[model samples]
Target: MTDEEPPAARRGPTWLIVVVVAAALAVCCCSGVIGLTVAGSAGLLGR
Candidate 1:
């Protein structure tokens, strides 16, 4: 039997995937905070 290296297609870059996921999380968190702020100001939070 011969041992050969895998193709590049099967070993894609992971940094790109990590960056995309991090950016998505940041956007979601920021939007949630902004929404709460707006709701509080409008007296929609029952405060």
Candidate 2:
């Protein structure tokens, strides 16, 4: 109800936060892999 309250108490749910963070991390990892693959191919192609 107030700033003095712990963040968890004021927030809705821990599992929801966990799920969102996990999904974000998965996206970042997948994107990073795709980027690396593209870069590697580009290097081979000298582009």
Candidate 2: pairs in clash: none
Candidate 2: tens digits of C-alpha lDDT, residues 1-47: 67657786646678788889999999999999998889888895465
Instruction: State the lDDT of candidate 1 residue by residue for 1-47, as single tens digits.
Output: 13344444444656668888999999999999999999999999999
Candidate of highest TM-score: 1
* TM-score, candidate number 2: 0.64
* Backbone clash pairs in model 1 (N, Cα, C under 3 Å; residues 3+ apart or in different chains), count: 0
Model 2 lDDT on a 0 to 1 scale? 0.84
Question: What's the lDDT for residue 36 in model 2?
Answer: 84
lDDT of 1: 0.83
User: What TM-score does each of the candidates earn?
Assistant: 0.73, 0.64
Task: Estimate every model's Cα lDDT from 0 to 1.
Answer: 0.83, 0.84
**Predicted structure with the largest lDDT when compared to the true one:** 2
